[model samples]
Target: MKKKTIIEIFIFLLLLVFGLHSDAQEDHSKMNMGQASNKDEPRVTVDVPQDQQSKIGLKTTKAKKEKTLHTIRTVGTVTADQTKEAHVHTKINGWIEEIYADYVGKAVKKGQPLFDLYSPDLVSTQEEYISAKEQKSAGSDIAKVALERLKLWGVSQKETDRLVKTRKAKRSLSFDSPVDGFIVNKTAIRGMYINPEMELYHIADLSRIWIVVTLYESDIATISVGDDAELRLPYDLNKTFKGKISYIYPEIETETRTAKARIEIENKDQKLKPGMFVNVEVKKDLGEAVVIPDDSVIDTGTRRIVFVKTSQSRFEPREIKVGPRVGNSFIVLSGLKDQEEVVSSAHFLIDAESKLQAALRKGESQPAGHQGHGK
Candidate 1:
């Protein structure tokens, strides 16, 4: 019985040893797994691989050092300059017995005879003048006054001189234009009877021209007298005429929501006339401003941005507020720094790349079925 008891104790001790050994094996296996996990840890880095980098082309521009605001654009019309505008009308209306100017739009000089008329009243005045001249040496002051009256009624100096020498009446009344202008209206025909005071013709002088310009109410504050303006005819856009603001209408036109500005331009050759439609551009000066090359900007609906290259193949887009232009460049009101490297020429490519990236990200956010792949 003593020997069996010892043997049972021995068996119990062996079983306990086996259990402890199994536990130790499990501990060693767990330690080895932890070590393997540590060995598999990835390295930390901030750079993207060359294949994953943005492949868009790029160009750069240095910001211009000037401070400018914005540009104003308006369209206007051309009008005859008031100074050169003329209205020619005849005071004495008579038959156009002999027409010197017979057509509309004919050019005439100042004091040029337009027509000749045979009038009984004119003939009677001339007869009185001839009798006055014959009696001038007979010591009558009334006769001398009648001769002066005939000279005042458009009888030419040469005609009066010939009448004084020949003592005979010259029997025709002459109508003369008082200004150098184009014949705008002609109401009289040859052999037509006329009244004492009637407008037989109309004339317009085309020495200088005007442009009727309209400026929006928002832009009216920027315009003032003597500001430079430009004109372009529709048929000849390449031809530009330069002028200055002469008048600014105090009242605003309600229907158009604009104010009228008058621009005076010289038209010595009569190329511009009344009722000419033209495109007018008011040239505003942006004295000095800080500007950027126009191409450097990328406009998102919500923000205007510019891409700044921080490192090779790396760019960051920044929001910016913009101002007016100083020629080919835009004034930077904010969100830009001088001397920074900006993608000027190929901004469109970079923008397109950004859009693709955004689209990809959006696709990843959607459900699998919504990604356009079959479920």
Candidate 2:
């Protein structure tokens, strides 16, 4: 009977111990479940007292709907307008007789003589035209053909009329400037033999000039032909010249990975010179949009977070989408509204305090038994 009582007591003790252990394990599991659930909860607002805010130098700015003007500033080089440039060439081979334009950089007007040329072929054609003119009934067709041939050889109609009136072929003919411009390049010499294939002079009209600015791939989308631009000399900022984007190179340069934008501005005073570097500013207005200060937003790798002041003391963290930056502000694409105040200064301190408070809350929600175990 004693042995049976002892064995029964031992079995009862074993059962009691196992039941307590199971209950403890169940409680621990419930604590773990509670912790996971708290972790899944949304972030809570941070409350910063006015005194604390003052201590932290906290500041806020209101998100507002306003026009965002983007200014693109870049350096540009002045170039002669290619379309306004003229190449002086001759059709028939000749020997340069009397140099008239004489030097490079000399400004010449239309019909101004550049040089005198003596070409055997030209003299022979002029004689034929003069003979045909003198033949009277030799027929007008022959003279007309000869005149057309002279025109084809680059002889102006005025020169041809002079020949007809003079009734003689001149030893040398004067080549006149076809356009008003400064001779940028001159290959003509006093006795240099010239051919039809040779370029005699390169004339550039400086009445208008082109300012070429480089546009990166990111900026190309915002720029277009006819966009207004302002240019200023590096040495003289007080003088400003206005222009419009006249052309954009279709292909980007392989080495620079940039496209060239051409701005045409009048240079009637010849103040701008080719190859001179100038400052270029292009302004684009991005219509009304919800905007906030640039410093208010924090990029946390995966998300862009901004703290919005929901109340005087309460700031709620919000994830927002943003577009291009305009000046010192950002264009808010979503997750924000106009007139809402957002925290601008001391963001790091606020963000850290918010996270600390969350961790403390998580700890407080833990079961007592688990807390004890952790302790």
Candidate 1 wrong stretches, greater than 4 Å: 1-71, 137-167, 286-375
lDDT for every model? 0.63, 0.79
Per-residue error for 12 in candidate 2, Å, reads 52
Q: Can you write out model 2's per-residue Cα lDDT over 44-159, one digit (the tens) per residue?
A: 45666665676567899999999888778888999999988889899988899999999998999988888888999878888888788777876567888888888888876677
User: In model 1, where is the ten-residue run with the lowest total lDDT?
Assistant: 39-48
Deviation in angstroms for 213 in model 2? 1.1
Cand. 2 Cα-lDDT: 0.79
Give TM per candidate. 0.56, 0.78
Q: Which run of 10 residues does model 2 get worst, by summed lDDT? A: 19-28
The residue ranges of model 2 lying beyond 4 angstroms of the native Cα positions read 1-50, 254-257, 300-303, 351-375
Best by TM-score: 2
